[model samples]
Target: MIVAVTYRYTEDVALRDEVRPAHRDFLRGLADAGSLLLSGPFGPAAPAGALLLFRADDQAQVQAWVDADPFGTRGVVASATVTEWDPVLGTLLPAL
Candidate 1:
């Protein structure tokens, strides 16, 4: 299954920046392990939030990742939400 994780950062961009390196490394690690599919922050004068795509067997796996994230541990992320995804129209038809 694919899980979508939406992370909302607090107003302190510096906090987010400070933790971003570790966060990116963590995501890169997940990518290497074939879990993370894509991730990027919302930008251009928008609220601080990011959308991350992951391939996980269940929400618990995704939650585990979230728990390990530096952004979460360091409190850079103010809130987060995870939802299972079903991609029905993409080139990766098998994903559905």
Candidate 2:
């Protein structure tokens, strides 16, 4: 299954910046383990949030990953939502 996670950042820019390296490192680890499919922040302006795609068994698994994220642990993320996604029309992902 594929899960999509959206993270709303806190207004504290300094904190988010400080935590970003660790957060990316964490995501890199997930990617190395074949869990993270894609991830990037919404940016070029003041970042409001980020989107992440993950290969997981279910929503709960993705939610657990979110809970363990550095952003969440350090309070840089104000909120996170996880939802199941069906990729039917994307060449980037195989049809499911």
Candidate 3:
């Protein structure tokens, strides 16, 4: 299953900057494990948030990952929404 997580950052820019390296490292570990498909922060023109796509066995597993994120652990994330995603046609992801 594919799980999509959206993270809205807090207003604390300094904290977010401080925690970003650790956050990226954590996500890199997930990607190395073949769970994180893709992830990126929203463009500067957009909102202050990020989108993460994960290939997981279930949403619960994705939730666990989200719970362990540095952003969440360090209080850099203001809010997060996790949802199951289905990709019918996408070159980046394998065909369903």
User: Which is the leading candidate under lDDT?
Assistant: 3
Query: Candidate 3 regions off by >4 Å?
Result: none
Which candidate do you rate higher for TM-score, 2 or 3?
Answer: 3
Per-model lDDT: 0.90, 0.91, 0.93
Per-model C-alpha RMSD? 1.7, 1.8, 1.3
Output the lDDT of residue 47, model 1. 81
lDDT of 1 by residue, 10-92 (tens): 88878888888999999999999999988999986878899999999999999999999999999999999999988878786
Q: Write the per-residue lDDT of candidate 3 for residues 1-96, one digit (tens) a residue.
A: 999999999889999999999999999999999999889999998879999999999999999999999999999999999999988776775532
lDDT for 55 in candidate 3 is 90
Q: Write down the worst ten-residue block by lDDT for model 3.
A: 87-96
**Model 2 C-alpha lDDT per residue in residues 62-84, reported as the tens digit of each score:** 99889999999999999898999
TM-score, structure 1 vs. true: 0.91
